[model samples]
Target: MICMDTTTAALTRDEIARFHQQGYLGPYTACTPEDMAAVRLRIDAEVLTSTGPNPASPLHSRHLDHRPVHDLVTLPGVLGRVRGLLGDDIVLWSTFLFNKEPGTPEVPWHQDIDEWPLDPPVNLSIWMAIDEVTAENSCVQIIPGSHRELLHHVPSRPGMVFSKEIEPGLVDTSGAIDMELAPGEFFLFSEQLMHHSNKNDSNRRRLGLSARYTTPSVNIRDQDSAPCFPGHACVLVSGSDTQGLNRMTEPPA
Candidate 1:
């Protein structure tokens, strides 16, 4: 059962079943576009330029240092849906600010579970669009039911965003679905889901934030901050971390 306050929108059993079957759910509305416009202003004014908690990437883990990011990560609309799958206790392990400018190269298909350092690699990720994401601007794409199996990955070619990617020829994305999102819209996906994005063909920039959550029982590589994670402070977003398995931090004050 989803553990959440009554005010939060909880997913129904059928919705939960579909998520497990398809490895994803939604294009849920987190907020009105106008409100998202206001939030986007704060993201631009206080977030994008800042080096955030993970200054190494300058784009990861801002939830630890920026109120806007923390708020987004803990938003009831998003977190409520996630509780259906991640259970009562949710610990946000990482948040990545994906800023794709014009001419950005494609992010080749990959499974997040393989790249993540967490033991057992159980993760529920929510990707929320902060700016309008369209097909031309390279919105995220995914293969349904792909999470049922983990594909092999190899060294990536030049110009791709990631250093490694799912080996070529193994993926058949002819049935892939492009996840076009509007501002304040978000989708919940499994860490094992196969997802990628094409190069930005338009002049406009696309901004999105990917928040990852797991239970406290899973081990975190909190000290090995590299690649993108810095400081790696996990925030308990729901219920309690009775397992006491990882370091926890309060939301940005």
Candidate 2:
């Protein structure tokens, strides 16, 4: 599958190899652009203004309460690729809407390993665009093969979206690639992959939803944690979670 719109999202050997070498894959179609338009309308009406489970973070865990968000999070084209990478058992530990309106500051150079917390510190994230993401609109950029090494992050500069960021000197900007994506399209990357979005330079807004997936084997810390607060729940997105190592919940009806 060379990034075509196919129901069977199984990866070819070459694709898997490329992912291993480069640390990311896609801009694959998960749903029709028209369908994403409908979802976007609902998100603007219901999700943007409403408070989710985490009061401090309004965009966290909308999949637990919003059916549309859950549907998009578990879309076959997207989840199938995840299943192809992460074996049979999968759990959606968290989903968050990343909306960057015009003037949204740069998200700084950082690996998600610093932002995302898990016992193993490994997970696949599918970031599906809700609004069309373009390089001018601050599309995510990544350094190929950067996931192989873990870098130190210091406190971020003022107006940055992240709390901590890798010092500019530590990252090699020469190989950075832009991950511009269309609405309903997504890319999968390891949590340790080095990625960031620049300041929005265009008038158009950029909105994307990132769903975090992992096998049930990884322990998602609960109750007063950076990744999980009280009332956190992980959805078994595919196959059997016989391990039951984390708190599981049903998707919204």
Candidate 3:
């Protein structure tokens, strides 16, 4: 159930309306360009020494393992906007760093809900730019109003970062909008929105941070009913979970 209180809304009525109509919003700044540059530098160093089994593993859930990420996700500007959309009681379900290095292949068209386990499938994602992102450097692209329904997705081809992609011919791209963002700016979108990024043809690498938030009432379920998916740890970022349904992980020290 949605629990919105307009008096405390982080976004204006107009902004919220646009988001509902377009499936996405912003370029809102959460930090200064200089600050983001420093974050990028630190992430670069950490990536080199990350001991995870694969490159992607280390970048996942940095909010739980890294203090900086935890702080960023909890920032008033970021979390406030999220609260405006999803309500006061929120659970931080996941975080990811999408570092598209030069020459990396495009992220095929897809929806974030395709592989998730949420029973009601209600989620809002905040994608923040860690570096200047432009059309030439693979900025995120989305199809307006596509979040109204789930689209067909097929297994992605080899070498793709995502394992699933929107099936060919299922979506018309005539109204797609490129989400160009400057460093430290962020855009929030629904989990079911049809979105993708192109190959980074520019010489510079494209780095973006994604934080996924949802109401605690949404139950996580899968065919096997596993305790929790590996690396799919969750934490209560705000308010109480009176229903006591989600099993939350403690924030890392």
Taking all chains together, the TM-score of candidate 3 against the true structure is: 0.88
lDDT of 1: 0.86
Tens-place lDDT digits, model 1, residues 1-253: 1112224679999999999999999898887677788888888998887777765777888888887788876878887888889888999988988999999999999998877778878899999999999898999999989999999999998999999899988999988998999988899999899999999989999999999999989988654556435456889999998888787889888
Number of the predicted model whose lDDT against the real structure is largest: 2
Tens digit per residue, CA lDDT, model 2, 72-109: 87877887888888987898999899999999999999
Ranking by TM-score: 2, 1, 3
Regions of candidate 1 where Cα sits further than 4 Å from its true position: 1-7, 227-230
Please list the C-alpha lDDT of all candidates, in the order they appear.
Answer: 0.86, 0.87, 0.79
Clashing pairs in 3: none
Model 3 gets an lDDT of: 0.79
User: What TM-score does each of the candidates earn?
Assistant: 0.95, 0.95, 0.88
Q: Give the Cα error of residue 155 in candidate 3, in Å.
A: 2.3
